[model samples]
Target: MPQTEHGANRRRGRDETEEERADRMWTDLIQEVRVAQTGVQILFGFLLTVVFTPKYAELSDTDQTIYIVTVVLGACATGALIGPVSLHRLVSGRRIKAQAVRWASRLTLLGLLLLLATTSAALLLILRVATHDGFVPYLVAGVVAWFLLCWFGLPLWTRHRHTVK
Candidate 1:
């Protein structure tokens, strides 16, 4: 859909009807979900194996608590990332591609947020355990701030800046 000066974009591309647009959006949403899903799955896998490591027994009570929190966060992230696929599978052939895309987009956003939290918690746990310095929290905070700026802040700013009134 090409935007003209009068805000008329024909509501679609030259070769695409509304249905086609919805279908394309659905495919794009699924592809994006796959990328996030892979990361969450990998992180969850690693977290699951952590408890069986010999170092797990040597962790202090606080480190152990952090580990538990991190693992739970990873689990939540995993669920959120994989949610869109299940949503699409259940809703297939229901003629709801537009609605499905909206729901999937929402799920993807939620998954990104969960991923942020999971990554932050994992970094905290790893840094604290690897180097019991007071700067671990600060370092993790810095990294989380960077992620926030890149993942959420900049996109929001661009959306607000470019949106027509």
Candidate 2:
């Protein structure tokens, strides 16, 4: 085989073409999204019902605002995470699965970020309503930090550590 500028073979250890790689990636991404979608959908469903509860009328204005923001963020996350399926369906015969996969991956990342914000806001609202303590912000910050570390930091660390030079 002829050598490309980057290397003798861009595919390296694999025998798949770009389309095949995209297909595989799309499958993997869909599987990953299923997990996140379930959690976000459940959380969003719960948030939707919170407003109908009798206790919801008793929350302070600030807490009400937080709840609204959390619900909006959850909605955005749900849309972004589900965007891939819509994209795939609409573009099924367009021969653009590679591009679709890339776009879907971006949407998934955006969804995860939104999920992080939604979760943090929900936590803050809950803690504020539950304890009304000065330490609530600190506690929420700690939990956000933990989520960031676990969700992003570890994957990044491993990617950086194992990347071929």
7-77 per-residue lDDT for model 2 (tens digits):
66554356899999999999999999999999999999999999999989999999999999999999999
Candidate 1 Cα deviation (angstroms), residue 7: 16
Cα RMSD to native, each candidate?
A: 3.4, 4.5
Residue 164 lDDT, candidate 1, scale 0-100: 57
Provide backbone clash counts, one per model. Answer: 0, 0
Worst-scoring 10-residue span by lDDT in model 1: 9-18
State the lDDT of candidate 1 residue by residue for 1-165, as single tens digits.
668899887654248777888888888888988888999899989999999999999999998998899899889888888888898899999988789889888989998999999999999999988898999989999999999999999999999998756
Kindly provide the TM-score of model 1 when superposed on the true structure, using C-alpha atoms.
0.87
What's the TM for model 2? 0.92
TM-score leader = 2
lDDT of model 1 at position 144: 96
| Superposition error at 105 for model 1 (Å) | 1.1
Give the C-alpha miss distance for residue 88 in model 1, angstroms. 0.6
